[model samples]
Target chain A: MTALDTARPGISPTAAASEVEAQGRGGGGGPSRRKVGRVLTWLALTALAVLFIYPFVWLLSASFKPRGEVFDNRLLPKTFTFENYIAVWQEAPMALWLFNTLLVTVLATVAVTISSSMVAWGFAYFRFRGRKYLFGVVLATMMLPQAVTMIPVFLIWESVGMTGTLTPLWAGNLFGSAFYIFLLRQFFLGLPRELFDAAKIDGASNWQIFTRIALPLCKPALVVTAIFEFQAAWTDLMRPLIYLRDSDTFTVPRGLKSLVDQFGFGGEWHWEILITASVISTIPMIILFFVGQRYFVQGIATTGTKG
Target chain B: MAVAADTSVTDSPPGRPPRRSSARSRETRAALLFISPWLIGFAVFTAYPVIYTGYLSLTDYDVINDPSFVGMENFRALLEDPKVALALQNTFIFAVLSVPTQLIVSFFLAVLLNRAGRASGFFRTAFFLPKMTPPVAIGILLLLLFNGQNGLINEALGWFGIDGPDWTTDPVWVKPGLVMMSLWTIGASVVILLAALRNVPQELYDAARVDGAGWWRQTTHVTIPMISGALFFILIVDTIAAFQSFTEAYTAFFGSGNTTYSNDAALFYAIYLFQQAFEFLHMGYASAMAWILFAIVLVVTLIQVRVTKRFVYYEGEQR
Candidate 1:
């Protein structure tokens, strides 16, 4: 198995058997049942994957199709045009939405990653009174639903005169995120304590040790934290809806909601324009996922099993 | 013996290292410095809000007026408010019906992917794309697909000579439609379950097969028990999330002003709370509703943990 394969505990039975079966086929033969099983597995997997992906495929096709042809059963547009994209741009403030979304996403990701890493490092390395209790409190925060805190938080923002701005949308991350802190703390604890002791002998302070040793060694975990934070901020809708009112400050989700309001749901169905806007909104996230699939997978795996 | 004693004394020279209390105090200072952000945030954002919400639940206040203590009037009002009961009923029904289906369907998908061999990564990503899709986009897509006459789902049903129900408009079908849409994002649970499945030992399955266990028997006796911890984790987390369902329902029904199709059928507990706080400016009542949700979730979680104690098998823990 590869090093990454050992990141988790168990091996895939099918993967292990396939290798043996391949060797057996090269030498003399394996059972016909095994070959049939492999074929059947492929067939079943292909069918399900298609079913899962069909909605996105349909969405992509409809984004290009003209309004008159949006309802046709054809998978591909009979007459493809850039008209829908142009219409979405001229009719809506797409650029402002992109700007606001990017601003919050980038700021939130950076702020959350740094603050969470620092807090996680403290929990990972320091020995202090009530540390265990403090960490338990952090874990407990994960179960606290946003609905529970929505009103008071809104009031807090309003009291500070930040309610109508995007500042409230992302300013919360400057404090820290519980899940990211937990994930990063697991990564920190895995580091050899000897490194920190050696740094201390070299007259490095705790801050220096964290900046010089812990942060550098835990690059993968840090990247995972940044990616998760960015994706969350990008996809978040409810917070923006609560905080933002003006269209100019609207994030992609709120902007997309407005598009739906203006076109899709108002008596006349403008599926072409609505679908185009949806496609535009999704493109960035899809690209990000494809580019960072490894980190994304690692983050999900660690979040599930790690304490 | 004299030399060894001298070396031991020299190991920690007098006046070289700081005092125990001094060193500990310094470390405490540093640790607090490192975690100061979280400490402040936990107090201001999380801790204060929860406690203040509890207090707000016992009072009557609007944004314009100072909150006055009302002594559980809002909670008592909940008994008389038909909308509050409907919202609670809708939330309960959504959680009860959706949680089990979510667990089964996601577990089945995870099982399929686990046996998928080298193509597992691709399939995992494909299935997960829907989960990654923004809730707003998914909401819009739901509206488009579930449109009564010209939606894609209805057209597909037409190909088979079946007329699909009007999912958005009909109150009877609304909850089911929301559940269906929610099911599209089961990738998170699938990923978690897949990881859990990977942690199960291969030897157990082999030993079961040797004991004449069929696929179904092996799955039931070996697979399920091994991953029970992860199963429980996702079940609790998903149920809590299901109770707070908002964005999807809001986008489909409330976002667009189509009163003909979208109605109170889509008025979930969280949505109603949003209405009370923002639309009607009933902050105190909304805070009361929020506390009730919190208590229900906490109690439900406790009950599940207690009930699952008999069934959930950890690897090394004793019965």
Candidate 2:
């Protein structure tokens, strides 16, 4: 906590901070060490940020460079070209992978949006015999690690004859991830009771109430669920690896993995082509957030609180 | 007030009075309709597989041939499997090494990002983007960095007059390299923790400051306890995830190579199970390994929940 503590060279940053701040000497010698401390902290933070971001920069720059120059330590390539984009495009079925991800993601997003809200509405208003148990079951699934259930699910998907198609991919998430179900249920449970009561008093059907009142009021939760689904559908590697066999059905991640294999033993390393493919895979996601950026904060804010 | 209208009055024998509110029945039907997809899915995908895996854990089920009902033998073999012991030891080490470090780093980064006035979102996004960047891309990126002959990390270290170890080849450095890769995706955890920090009911902050508490005092006593719910949540999930570090390790070190390591370092539990299931085709033994992992997660998570009582703070929950 003082000069004595700083003498221990092995103290990590967390300990150092806790010590300095807790001891009230972090401000430093009025002005001189204070400046030094501030400068050092920012420098450290800047280095960490670069460590985090520089790879993507290298990725972009190397995607344009030749194989020989890929390992070169430079921020920008000596020359830039569209060769990577063209080669990757011509060599692989990037378009098909993009299409597969979009179809499954959109359909699954819609399914999750509707189903989660509906189920959440039921959990909120319904006083059924086993309602609590049902909600508990949905929540419990969130804690069940996907790795544990993965092989079993794989065997089942193969058994159903849905393997090597887009059906298994979307269907797995269409019923909704436990995250969305819990998120929607939390939001729905928070809604005012009188709205449902009024809709019913008007002789509205349960579907009508759900469609008109519940769904309309749940835009935030729906967007949040859709965001989660978009990310999952976009970035998933393992599911498509097993169920999908054909190049035509590959998602972006799986497609990237294929780029390595297609270039077999004799083929040259297409650093440019691979980076461009990786760059393209991230485009839809960036676009999703750019358009849905308003709801992005809302999405993360509401998840995992109740569940 | 939400009672279904007395439509039975006309259908029934001019019932003396309308049946008690049919709301409950309608609600039940609505509940059933709502969860139909999930219920069907649960029955088809989750429920069946969960039970089936449990059944598989007991038998020798290799997909290439019929599953023989060799009860307890698979599990017994699991105990004696040296790889199983090694993998279990490796998993605990990875978890112990990664979880606390990750939590500390992410929380601090979240704290720093939370303090930004104008560029907060930018910093937050910058910090969190790695979590979104495809892990496949990340694997490739790590491979690029860890390459012995020509890697940027080594070149950078060379500039400092120190020779960096061959990150991929060396057994001791391989897992640490994998753990480093895991930290890049701190965005989701940071975002969740940030939200919790934002939720720390500002009154507590004001009260702490009123008592002349500095930022450290305020954070330790007030901010952390208030966000203890989120911290506890991330701790449990992160620890469990650390126990299952696979794809990153699998890709970076063993893209196509077959080694238990020249020194046997990167053979993680999940990776070992992966080799058994897909590569070696020892499905029965792999199933047993998986069950062991499940048991590990269940027991650890249960222990976490139990141990969290002293630290986690739920503002509205009854004491």
Most TM-score-accurate candidate: 1
Q: What count of clashes does model 2 give? A: 0
Worst 10 residues of 1 chain A by lDDT: A1-10
- DockQ per candidate: 0.44, 0.28
lDDT of 1: 0.83
lDDT of 2: 0.72
Which pairs of residues collide in model 2?
none
Off by over 4 Å in 1: A1-30, B1-18, B316-319
Which candidate gets the maximum lDDT versus the true structure? Answer: 1
Could you tally the backbone clashes for each prediction?
0, 0
- Residue range B40-117, candidate 2, lDDT tens digits: 877777787777777777777778687788889988888898988988888888898888888999888777655432
For residue B218, model 1's alpha carbon misses the true position, in angstroms, by 0.8
What's the i-RMS for candidate 2 in angstroms?
Answer: 6.8
lDDT of 2 at B258: 34
